[model samples]
Target: MRAQSSATGRTAKAVTPPHAPSSARPAGRGAGTGAGTALALSGVFCFSLTFPSTVWGLESFGPWSLVALRGVLAAAVAGAFLLMWRVPLPDRRHWAGLAVVGGGVVIGFPLLTTLALGTSSTAHAAVVVGLLPLTTALFAALRTGRRPSRPFWAAAVAGAAVVAAFTWQQSGGALSVGDLYLFGALLVCAAGYTEGGRLASRMPGWQVVGWALVLCLPVTVAGSAVALALEPVHWSAHGAVGLAWVAAGSTFLGLYVWYRGMAGIGVARASQLQLAQPLMTLAWSYGLLGEELTWAAPLAAAGVLICIAVTQRACD
Candidate 1:
């Protein structure tokens, strides 16, 4: 859980005990919650294109370069907004959480998933990341003491199991290095989302994301430099467009709305909205990357959607 204290400095615990009882719950199924769900869905839509975009980017840039350059570009946009709005610095108590968000979301997820994408098809990667909602909920419950009801957990597990089974069937029931990377991405990204959601409650979602991007500027700038120097580059129309989308749409705008959604709805409830992301990604992969649309996808989508509906009701 976040340190709930006054503006005056005071020692406070940053995380909840593992067995901590659920102290947080969704307020109700109100207009604000509905709006939050909508915002979260929009973010999911943006993110659904990420794997295809990264595939396009890899045509010109190496995995390291694409990941680092996107971070630099995203930070530049975020910085411009922060300057225009004259957003003040976050409290010191929040910086640790911001650091976690920067490391996991900005750096870790992008790099790991990009590497995984070099070997794995976008459809495969999307199905694997379908597990993210459950991972995020687990992190949120641990970090924020927000425990969802048993029905919510059941629905979450069902959604995740559907995705996992789909992934397993697709991968021939074997683990690859790409699968390992995706799993790692899940852990770090989940932690980042949980922390970002916690921080969003104290400030505007855009500010939370903007500041985290700014916080990682130095590392990203240097990484961009090193990656460009070492990796060969070939400029292309698709590469440029892909880079632009991942930077502006996925990294900046998507996260801004996502954190906002998590702030409006509780983190656990908001996360379940991502159950649709893999299906959306599958559609994108088929259309954009010309990946084969597996027959199992439709079934997985049905199961995931039902789970999402159940989780939303259970949360309420």
Candidate 2:
């Protein structure tokens, strides 16, 4: 969706109509499409642990403080990468896109999810994130102008419905504010994913994220410092470790590949693979958070996978 242009003075605008036909795309993306998909899946797997890790971190760190710390840590890593690689500064056109990516992923989604998971169960948060792929695809469609087939929408909606129903049942047939937080997380995360995907098509995946993080570094550093000072933390080793892992994996490396995959395969197809994330979260809950996996978890996983597979097979 993104191609480098000689003109670089304006806020980034879609170069082509977002609803253009797939046949309109150029062919250079083919060489790395498969690799990108693999990388995206790997990113997803790494991200699956984020919820459980957040739950752990919340045991010692305040939600805002934890968020700030994670962002700062992640910014450090991203800054190092950009410096080591001597990544060229983004031009004005690309700067707008990078800002969108930074706002969505680097700042918005992390802050929201951290706050949400402070009160919500890791397992529940994971299941809720299952909504992400559909939302991500939606943003991709809007931005790139390629549409999913009707059947794709159907399966996607059904899968979301299944998750919603299960969540309602689990919560005693009532929804709560946490669901709202998760939904908010979904929106911002999808926006980030969409913008990053667009940018990834024109640059190296790692550099895209590194630059975004570097772009946000100033705010992230100040925010974390203020949060830590304003609210005292319990400061456990477990929380520190959890925070570090999320900073390194979820905040940086995972996004590096995720954007690449979305750029390579088209967001709709690439995103369907995120159906596995909730199940992976469930596993992490059991193993790391010591939550018992219920029979319903496996059933839900199977159902979501089937729906995603159906969605993936649809012809646009």
Candidate 3:
């Protein structure tokens, strides 16, 4: 997930120019920090609901249907927004990066995670995905040529260790097929997040995701048609709502804010905020799916939150 701007294709205005007067610097910095943090947190909240929503969707839609339909549906919404604002196509030079974003975020992650949810409980899948923040930070560092502080790495590592330990304990120390799918999702999604954050610095965060979704429209449309034909639909209220949330809330809106936040705050710090996401998903799973909440949840959540605080303070 990803940054902010107007519907008319403006980039984020939160950044303070290096040429700005010293007297104006502090206020500009403060505003940018506050807005960036809020946007990142909003994205986290939207994503936290995804696993539970996917589980609910699986009740009526097959994994393939759920994944393809979510993409198609999200694309339609993004396409409409782009047209409404007359957003121009991205530059040719940016297409390769956009392809990575489209392939990974729009295609790879959703498909793999949906498949994983078939066998794994939302809580288990969520904790596994908790590895995403660190993965994304590593990707951002390599791709964007920005290095975070050693303290930040220490906190990020500690958080990942907590999540890994929790997943291992929950899964009885054996990797399931679902775990394999989730790990795959983690790697691809991290690449997408890092690239999306880079692109957001040049364009509106919403447009980066908007264009990526639009770029995948052809494949998603075809996939949706074929998947709907093959998958048996058993539609219900939960299924309908679940599909709607994943498509609208998680895919488009979540990514828009997330990319913008990354542009505002830097990808590494924005990603650390996601340490809260798995815990939020755990709560959603318990409440929405009535899945058993384990005793390990509180311990893991506390550890992750402390890590988040440390990383946030550790500086870029």
Clash pairs of candidate 1? 1-16, 1-143
TM-score of 2: 0.88
**CA lDDT of each candidate?**
0.85, 0.78, 0.86
Looking at model 3, the pairs that clash are 2-258, 2-259, 2-260, 3-259, 3-260, 3-261, 4-260
* 263: Cα error in model 1, Å: 0.2
How well is each residue in 1-316 modelled by candidate 1, as lDDT tens digits?
2333446565454443354222112212233877888778888988988999999999889999999999999999999876764445667878899999999999999999999998898988888888999999999999988788999999999999998898788779988899999999999999999999988877678878888999999999999999999999999999998999999999999998888888888789888898888888888988898888778876787678778889999998
- Model 2 off-target regions past 4 Å? 1-32
Clashes of each: 2, 3, 7
Residue pairs that clash (backbone atoms under 3 angstroms), model 2: 18-144, 18-145, 19-145
lDDT of 3 at 181: 99
Q: Please, what is the TM-score per model?
A: 0.90, 0.88, 0.90
C-alpha root-mean-square deviation, candidate 2: 6.4
Kindly list the per-residue Cα lDDT of model 2 for residues 1-316, writing each as its tens digit.
Answer: 4433346544443343355323123322664666656777888888998888888788788888888788888889978766654445565578888888888888888888888776677887888788888898899899889888889989888888878777787778877778778889899888888888877777666767878888888898888888888877887888888898889988887887677666777677878889889988888898888887667766776678788678767833
Write down the TM-score for model 1. Answer: 0.90
